[model samples]
Target: MTGFDPDWWCDGAALRGREYLSISRDGVELARAELDPQSTDVDEYTGLDLPATVVKIEFFEVRKQLRGRGVGRWAVAALIQHYEGPWFTVAAVTAAGFWTSIGWTEARHAARPCSSTARYLFNANALPSLDHGSDL
Candidate 1:
């Protein structure tokens, strides 16, 4: 049941603020997620007012063979447990449904302008209580 862990300082000592999580198995890299602790892209893209402390899953991808094997869900869940505050991501059109299935909700902001892309938010208060190994 061993899963991924966030190598918070993967970018090295000098670039500590820019963090990335490497998901691996037996030393093989399976996936990686770029984390932005102070991302304002949510506001810039959707006009939603999110706190500066919110962790944005800026970029996430798994190897093609790893898809549908629950790796993505585990990575996200691990991140939620590792980080504090809210979580959010501007999901690509193709991946919006997956995000929703995993407990993320479409964040609606009155000021949000009409856009072709979808924005999702995982408010800490609204998160479902899930066990570490539970299927998301």
Candidate 2:
């Protein structure tokens, strides 16, 4: 189960427009992602303000038992189908490859070694431009 951190999620910006979509089976929440109408800052790397019409896929996670079962893909596809917005974005660290393989392009930024987290961005309008092949 994914931990709910409303404080970390709402350190800044308005959360009223955010909608969370969950994928569950047999009473288990295997995967989930948030549909945020207002996108956060990309360049500055701070959770503040909307980045235009970008629908940010915030806080996505798939359970370990459900990994590699394609359930994650199905969940994302469902979200895409239901989403009315034109563009979507997501920021991932370890799961960047998985998202890229599903056709979400990377919004490149200078590699900052400040923390163990590796940030990646994806757009809905174009196929993902992966710097490396899918291995994760």
Candidate 3:
């Protein structure tokens, strides 16, 4: 998989509250997502004065014509890495397998759902202490 250009994601994410990102492979756009780049001085995990990055995928969709070809997984995983830590998404019940297959843990046990759909999280670097945001 082509690595995400780090220089691109953070700049756009910091410029506004949420950023629109699309994943394309072989020049064809396969997926798109809405990401919230939470840039803060204090880390949510440690409460230390350090740079912390938390990205939330408010919406994600794979092109209807191409559903199960690993595009969605790659797109999501890339965003998770590109954004760097604690990625959250509101996912449909039917898509639970896809999320879990990619190592995202269900948030019902870790955090309460604040939305109609279920929530999933991937906080690779730290011990999770989840706080669900009503907006997501």
- Residue 19 in candidate 1 has what lDDT? 70
Q: Estimate each model's TM-score.
A: 0.68, 0.59, 0.59
CA displacement after TM-score superposition, residue 75 of candidate 2 (Å): 0.7
Model 2 misplacement above 4 A: 1-15, 25-28, 40-51, 109-136
Mind sharing the TM-score for model 3? 0.59
TM-score winner among the candidates? 1
Residue 122 lDDT, candidate 2, scale 0-100: 44
- Residue-level lDDT for 61 in candidate 1: 73
lDDT of 3 by residue, 1-136 (tens): 3244343444444445878888877798787777677733222322222235546666677776778887787777667656656544444466778888877766542132344455566664552322332111
Question: What are the per-residue Cα lDDT tens digits for candidate 1 across 33-62?
Answer: 777777656554344556666677766777
Candidate ordering by lDDT (highest first): 1, 2, 3
Q: For candidate 2, lDDT tens digit of each residue in 30-131? A: 676666766654453343232455667777766666689887786776566566345667767567788877776555444453655545444433435223
By TM-score, is 1 or 3 better? 1
Residue pairs whose backbone atoms clash in candidate 3: none
Candidate 1 off by > 4 Å: 1-17, 42-50, 128-136
